[model samples]
Each structure stands twice: as structure tokens, then as C-alpha cells.
Target chain A: MRVALADDGALFRDGLVMLLEAAGHEVVGCTADGDTLVELLATEPADVAVLDIRMPPEPDGGLSTAERLRADHPELGLLFLSHYAETHYLIRVLNIGTQAIGYRLKEKVGSVEVLSDTLTRIRDGEIVIEPVLAQRLVDRPSSNRRDMLATLSDRELDVLRLMSEGRSNAGIASLLFVAAKSIEKHISSIFMKLGLPSDAAEQHRRVLAVLTFLRSVQDSG
Target chain B: MTLDTYDATGSARRRADEHWSRRRDLERQLHDGPALRIAALTLRLGLLAQKARHDVGGLPHDIEELQYQLHLIQQELRAVADRIYPPLLHEAGLGPALRELASSASVRVDAGGGRFDPAVEGVVYFVIVGVLAALPPATRTVDVVIRRDADGLALDLGDVDTGQIGAVRDRVRWVDGVAEVGDGLIGTIRVRIPCE
Candidate 1:
């Protein structure tokens, strides 16, 4: 994958370049802030653009840049790295777009393996959320929400948590040590229980299920 | 007329002192926490890079320690960030932010939900936090009511320590708000800030 990036932090940017190179992805452009990254992207194209959520030109310049990138190059993948895992940032990232996008903690994505997998998942047009954020949404006591979330059994909740993390059926099966077929059954059951339409495409259904979970948590907060 | 002049000068001096004290605390927090950890991480990373070239087998444990240090830096930075301006205050608005604050507060907080002017929200939110922090350690429970009405926003705090009432009054008065404290063994503070 060809990647362009922006971050005001020189050290993190340099280390990220090293990590991406080690993972075998090409770093097409590196810049300090969103403005420079925008100028670089005009000529030096990339499959994905990694950005820091807080940077120069504005505190939330990365979010503004993502909006611009979405408008100019709708096909490009976006990954936001941040030091904090606040829901507000996640909501802002999701507001830009849900597909072909990811929001991961800066420390969590330092490893080559996680970085590579995150890039691949975004390129595949999946919504990848940080696992810590996913855990918060899932671990909120069931009694707090009187919606469809309460109907999910403990095992189903586990599957929902992994699904929110952008895990595929096979990936989830491998992690949970269950058969692929069983994973499929649990997912379909989840969709039905959540009132998601059966005819919708798998990707769309997954997004809807995740959206339901998030909205319930957001409203209750 | 002379008494009024003296009162004005006294208040001005107090404000200047408070401003200076806050700056000093901020500097101390930054220097003592994330700043020191980040400097240490730079050396550790340099060492790890060298080790990676020669001793790949020992790299995993070294990397784990680096991650732990990074985590601590993040936590420290979060405290600094909250003091500057809680991200939630601007991102999610005041109501949700207050609810989040309530979740972790030592005393129970019933923060009613409603959006107001951002500046007003900031003043009110911080005032509540300040008042809660000032309460006596032995004081266990206090009820906080934040409500919005046609006229303005009202905050009713119960069981405040008498010693902190004057400070609370000054903070609220800075925003052109009225704060009335009850006279009793345990006090209550009622504040009203009009919303335009």
C-alpha cells in the first residue's frame, strides 16, 4: 500500500514511517500538518492517508483534512491516530464517513502487525474502531440500556464486540475458537435480534448493527 | 468612597495572585509528568533501535516496557489536556460532558441534560468541579442539581463547607451570576446564570 501521513509530532511521525516501512508499505509522502499533507497529496497520491487527530492550522485540523480528502478523493482510505480514546473523536471520525476508515489509539498501533492489519482492513472498506473504545461500548451494564442490546446473550455480546472491532467471520471464529459456520449463525441471529433487514448486504448490515450499539450508548450517556 | 477604593484594589490583587498560582501549577504538572517521561522514552527508544540490530531475541520485553511508558505518558497528558479544556466540553457539548464527569465523581451528581452557550457551559462546569474539590474530606455526600429554565440556568449544591463559600461566590460572580449560600452547620449554594 502507498501511504501519505501528517502529524505535528516529529518523533511519532518518524517512528510511524519506520513501522510502515517495516510492514512493507510504501510511504509516499510525510508532512507535519494537514495543510502540507493536502499539498503533497495533490501530486503524490496514496492509497491511504494516516493523520493525527490533533495538529496545526487548528486543534482538530486532521478532522477538517479528512473531510477535504473525502470530498477530493472519495476512494482514499483514512486512518486517525490519537493519544486519547474519547467517544467525541470517534463520533467525529464516523461523521466523516464509516467505510474505508479507522480510528486507533496511537500506542495500540505502534506494532508492525497491528499497523499492517489496520491498513489492510481499511483498504478492504471496513470500519475499524479501537478495541478499547469497543470494550467501553460493550461493557456498559446491560441494565443501563433497555433496548435490543439487552436481548443479546453473553456470547452474542462477545461476538458483537469483536464485530465492532472490524473482525471478519473467519477472524472472529479463529479468535473465539469456534467453527466458521457457527460464527455465521451467531451473526445472523444478532442481526435478526437487532431488527436489521435480512436483505441488506453483509457489510451494510454489519455497519447498521454497530450503529445501533453506538447510538444506544450515546443516547444513554 | 475610600472604603470602596480599598475593596477594588484588594480584589484586583487577589485576582493577580490566583492567576500567577494557576500558571505555576500548570508548569509544574507539565515538567514533572509527561515531559520527563517523554525524555526518558527518547533514550529508551534509541537503545531499543541499537538492540534491534544486534539482539532481536530480547526485543519483545523491551518493546512491552516502552508501550507501558507510552501509556503512562498518555494518561498524564490527558490530565493536562482536561485542565486546559476537556475535549468532551467542545466535542460532545456540556450536558454529556457533565454526565461523564459525574460518572467518576466521588459524590453522586445528577447533571440534568441540556445544551447551553459554550462559554456559559465552561464556567458552570468548572465551577461545579471546583466546588466539589473544595468540599471537606470528611463530607461524604452532596447532591448537585443543574437545571435549565426559561430565564436561565440554575445550580443548587447541597452541603458545601462554609470555608469555601466565599471562594465559590467569587467564581460565580465573575460570570455575572448570583450565588447565595445558606447559613447553617452545613451550607448550600444556589447559583443562577442567565442565558441569552
Candidate 2:
């Protein structure tokens, strides 16, 4: 996979380049700010662009850049790396677009497996949210009486969480050591429980719908 | 009202400005220095752990423990940095920042409004957080509303006594804003700051 990165911290950028190369992904270009990432991507296109949410031009320049990049190049994957896993950044990142996007904490993404998996999921047009943030979304106390999330059972909540983490039903099934068909059943049951309008045509879109639901829940609270 | 009082307020404002800047700088240093360096090291260690796994069929327990310890340090550093200065306040604005601050508060805070000048936001955020902290342990009910009208930004704090209003007054006054206690023993503290 071809990956571009923009982060103000030079040390972290260098380390990221090394990690990506070690993970067998091409580091197309590396820069220190969102503006430079825009320029770099124009000249050197990448399948995915990893950004630090806090960078030059503005405190949340990465968000604005992601929005622009998504507008200009719809196919490009975006993964935002932040030092802190604030749900606020996750909300903004999801607002940009649910597809081919991810928000992961910097410390957590150090693992090559996690980084590689994230890039692959993004390239596959999935929304890759950090697991911790997803767990928080599940655990947060819902003030609204009509909160659909409260309807989900513990096992259902686990499925929804894995779905939010960009895991395919099959991937989730493997992790849980369940059969593929059962995972599908659990997911469909989840969508029904959450009162998500049925749209069985596209699996990824369902994941996105769940993500959008989570975002709305976060916004309301 | 008098020159002495005016100079004192000016000096106090200057001190607040300096304090905010210092906190911001310290936050930046923590963010860009040790935080980044530690993160970089974590990345390298991750790669090393992968190699160890490939060669030894699994990660050594000590290496895993070291990585866990480093991750904890990173989290601690981030918490400290957020305390020194919330990055969200600078990145996102007062509303989101206040909501983040209020999440941990025992009282309810309906943090509404939008972006204002950074200086105005700093003062309002600082004053609100300080006031909330000073609430008595037994104090149960408190209301915080942040709104912007034709005049400027206004923060209305209900159920706070006059005693608590003094610090609120000084904090708001530093930004050339007005903080007034309503007509009751335990009244609301209304603060209005002009925003351009």
C-alpha cells in the first residue's frame, strides 16, 4: 500500500516512515503540516494518508485538510493519528466521511500489525475507529430515554464495537471463534435492535450507518 | 473606577495573559518533546517486538511489559498536558472545550455558543472551571450556560452565592467584562464579555 503522512513532530514522522517501511508499505511522501501533505499528495498520490490531528496552519488543521482531501480525491484513504484519543476528534473525523477513514491514538498505532490492518481496512473502504474510542461509545451513559444503543445486549454490543473498528463480519467471527453465518445473524440483529433502516444491499454502508448512529449519540450527549 | 484600581486590574490581566501563555508553552513542550519522543520509541519497540515474535515465535514477557509501561507513561503525559492546557480549547473552541471540561464536573453544564476570540475563550473557560472547582462539596445544584448574543458572549451561573462571585468578578474583569451577582443571598453570577 502507498501511504503519505503529515505530522508536525519530526521525530514521530521519521519513526512512522520507518514503521511503515518495515510493515511493507510504501511511504510516498512525508511532511510536517497539512498544507505540505496537500501539496505532496497532489504531486505524489497515495492510497492512504496518515495525519496528526494537531499540526500547523491551525490546531485542528488535519481535520480541515482531511475534509479538503476527501473532496478533491474521494478514493484516497485517510487515517488520523492523534496523541490523545479524544472522542471529539473521532466525531470530526467521522463527519468528514465514514468510508476509508480512521482515527487512532498515536501510541496505540505503533504496532505494525495494527497499522497494517488499519491501512488495509481503509483501502478496503471501511471506517477504522480506534478500539478505545469505540469502547467509550459503548460505555458512555446515554441521557436520552429513547437511546437505541441501550437496547443492545452485551454480545450485541461486542459485535457493534467490532463493526465500528472496521472489522468485517468474517473477521469478527474469527476473533470470536463463531461461525460466519452466526456473525451475520448477530449483525443483522444488531441493526434491527438499533432501529437502523434496513439496507442489506451494501455491507460497508451498514457499518457506516452504525457509525453514523454512534456519532449522533455522541453529539446528543 | 480609580487609577489605582485600573492599574491593578491591568496588571492582573497582564499576569493572567502571562500565565496562559506559559501554560500553553509548557503544554506544547510536553507535546512536542517527551510525548513525541516516547511515541517514536514505542513505534520502534513495536517493530522490534514483531521481529522478536518472528524469530522467537512470541514476544518475551519483559518486552511486552516494557511496552505496556511506556504506553502508560504516554497516557500520563497526555493527561498532564491536557491539564496544563486543553488542546481541544485551542483546537476546537470554547463550547466543545467546556463540554469536555464539564464531562467530569459534578454539576450540569449546558455549554452552548460558538467560537470567539482565543483570548475571550481562555478567560471564560478559566473562570468557569475555577468557579466550578470552588463549589462546596455539599453543594448539589449548579447551572452553567454559555451563550452569545448581539452584545457578546455571556456565561450565566445559577445558584452560586455572592462569596463565590468575587473570584468570578476578577476573572471576568481581566477581559474587560462585567460579572454581577443577582439580587439574592444565593444568586446567579452573570458574566458578559464583548466579542469582536
Candidate 3:
């Protein structure tokens, strides 16, 4: 598979090139910024374009690249790597009118084999979502959304509902007279069932989950 | 004077004063504390990761992964720093800062260029950010151009709704700037504040 890579961070970009090359994929194009990525994709023959969601010069370099790539090369596979599970960015990604795209967390690229597999899968016309963003889709208002949230038990729902109110885990624990560890467990379960990631970007993940929970209720209201 | 008149004037003054104090506190905390600490930590990690990668016979997978994770951590911290106080607004100036804000949102912001007071630049930087932020992501395009007015610096924010300018109006007013937000297909938020 031929892949093009774009990221402003030279270290990360070099690591990505090594990963792709080690996996036996051709790194036909390399660029440090977004506009160049779009340009490279246009001229270089590549099955997939992997982009960092944020880059320099443009506040949303990755996003602008996505827009240009989708518009200019509709058939080209796009795989966006982001630092956070930013739902707003996700929404914009989806709105670009292509289903065969991949949005994955940057840190999760640690699994090079999985990364290569995802790129191939995306090239084959599947929309690959990072677990966190997948959960957000499940939390949106719909029958499927309700069924997904129903996977959480009554206690879990109570925890999530309180979380949607912007209470910290410790605060919620105090309110419910439960141990902080137990609240953490429940929140973990909430994330697990909703498809959010379990990692160091805890604040971003928590906000994404709560935003989904809030949207579900707001829509029902 | 009536008690109601006294209360209204007093309350207005109090609210503005409180906002100024809160902004100062937030700015001081960000500038003097967390932002520097985060930048230092990021630098330390980068150095460590670089050493770890070379200190080993070859590029160790664990150290490489550590490098990747540190990069993410560093980016998030910088984002937090920008949210608290935009670094570009200070280091580069308003035009670059506004451009950063526009590019981040994937919206086009064409800002007029001129060096101004730091406070004026900060106010304009955030007001444009606030206005763009309040608009639905559905809003695809916005134009911001500055002008040298006879009285003050003039900012014309085109492609905005009157409602979208509420946040901008409040911030502009804080610096004793005049704001005119109106409704149209090209709803505009025009502001002019004297340089302090």
C-alpha cells in the first residue's frame, strides 16, 4: 500500500515513516505541513493519506487538509491522527462528505501493526473510528443511541448523569457516598461501554463522554 | 438620585471591575505558573526521549512509544496555554494571532495588520475568537479586517449574525470600545476602541 504522511512535528513524522516502511508500505510523500500534504496527495500516487489533526501555520491544518483532499481526491483514503477525541473535529471530519475515512488517536499509533491494518482497512472503503469517537456516535440521539446507553446499568446511568452535570469523580463519589475508586470504576465502565479510550487524555475523554450524555438528554427534552 | 439608579450604576461598575480582576488572576496564573511549567516539562521529556532513543544500541520500541506519547502531552499542554492566553497575540502580534485562531477553527479570517497596544491586541484577538467560537460550526467563512479610524482602531467582522456578536460586544465594551452588531445575510460586528 502506498501512504502519504503529513505532520508538523518532525520527530513524530519520522517515527510514522519508519513504522509505515517497517510494515512494508510505501511512503511515497512526506511533508511537515498541511497544504503540502494536500499537494503531495494530488501529485503522488498513494492509496492513503495520514494526517495529524492539528498542525502549524493553520490552527486546523489537519482539518484543512482533510477538506482539500476530500474535495480534490474523493477516492483517496484519509486517516487522521489527533491528540484528543475532539467531537467537534470529528463532526467536521464527517461533514466532509466521505465515509471511507479513519480518525484515530495519535498515541494509539504505538501499535504499528494495527495502524497499518487500519490504513489498509480504510483504503478498502471502511470508516475507521477511534473508540472514543465511536462512542460519541452511539451517544447521539437515536434508537441506536438509546440501546447503546441502555447497556449501562441503573447505577452506571446515575453516575453518568451526575457526570453530565460537570461534577468531578471525587465530587460525585462524595455525593453518592461511594468510594472514589468505585466512582472511577463506574466511570471506566461508562467509557468502556460507550467506546471511549482509557488513557492519559482523561479530561478530553471525560468531556467527550459527558457531551454525548448531555446531547442524548437535550434531544429527548 | 433614585436608589434604583444608584444600584444600576454601581452594579454595572462592579461587574466590569470583577471581570477585570478575574481576567488578571487567570492571566497571572497561566503566565507565571502552569504554562511555563508545562513548557519546561515538555522540553525535559523531549531531551530524555532523545537520549533514550540514542543511548540504546538501536531505536528501542518502548522509547519510541514514549517519544510519541510525550509529543501528544506536549501538544495538549500548548493548547491549554493558548486557551488561557494566546502566546502569538503577545510574541507575534494581533494579525498572526487572529490568523491562528481562524486556521484552528478551519475558518478563513483575513485580519488587517498594524501594531497596537498589548491590551488592545489581546481584546481584539479574543473577541474575534469568541465570535467565531459562538457561531455554529456550520458557519464556513468569516472575514475580519482592521482599519485606522480617525478616532480609534476599527474592526469590521463580516459574515456574522447579530446574536453571534454578543460575546464580542461584551468584551469590546470592557475596554470602553464602541460596538455595532447588526443582522443581515452579511451581519456585521463593527468595533472601535481607542488605544490605551
lDDT of 3 at B125: 75
Interface RMSD of 3: 11.6
lDDT of 1 by residue, A101-214 (tens): 999877667566667889999988988999988887677522234456778888899999999998999999999999989999999999999999999999899988887767
- CA lDDT, every model vs. true structure: 0.74, 0.78, 0.66
Query: What is the TM-score of each candidate's chain B when compared with the real chain B?
Result: 0.67, 0.76, 0.69
Ten contiguous residues minimizing lDDT sum, candidate 3 chain A: A212-221
Per-residue lDDT of model 2, residues B105-173, tens digit only: 434466668787656778888887787777775454567788999999988987766677888887777
Candidate 1: CAPRI quality band? incorrect
Per-residue CA lDDT of candidate 3, range B1-196, in tens? 8775676644754575565445545754653354334433333443344445546555455555564665566457656766765655544466656644543353444455467765566677778878777778754467678876677789888787678666777787766787887757458889998753
The candidate that wins on TM-score is: 2
Top lDDT prediction, candidate number: 2
By lDDT, rank the candidates, best first: 2, 1, 3
Docking quality tier of model 3: incorrect
Q: Give the Å shift of residue A68 in candidate 2.
A: 2.6
Task: Please give, for residues A156-217, the per-residue lDDT of candidate 2 as tens digits.
Answer: 77887788788888899999899989988888787677666775565755665566546544
Name the best candidate (by DockQ).
2
Of 1 and 2, the candidate ahead on lDDT is: 2
Q: What is the Å distance of residue B85 in model 3 from its true position? A: 5.5
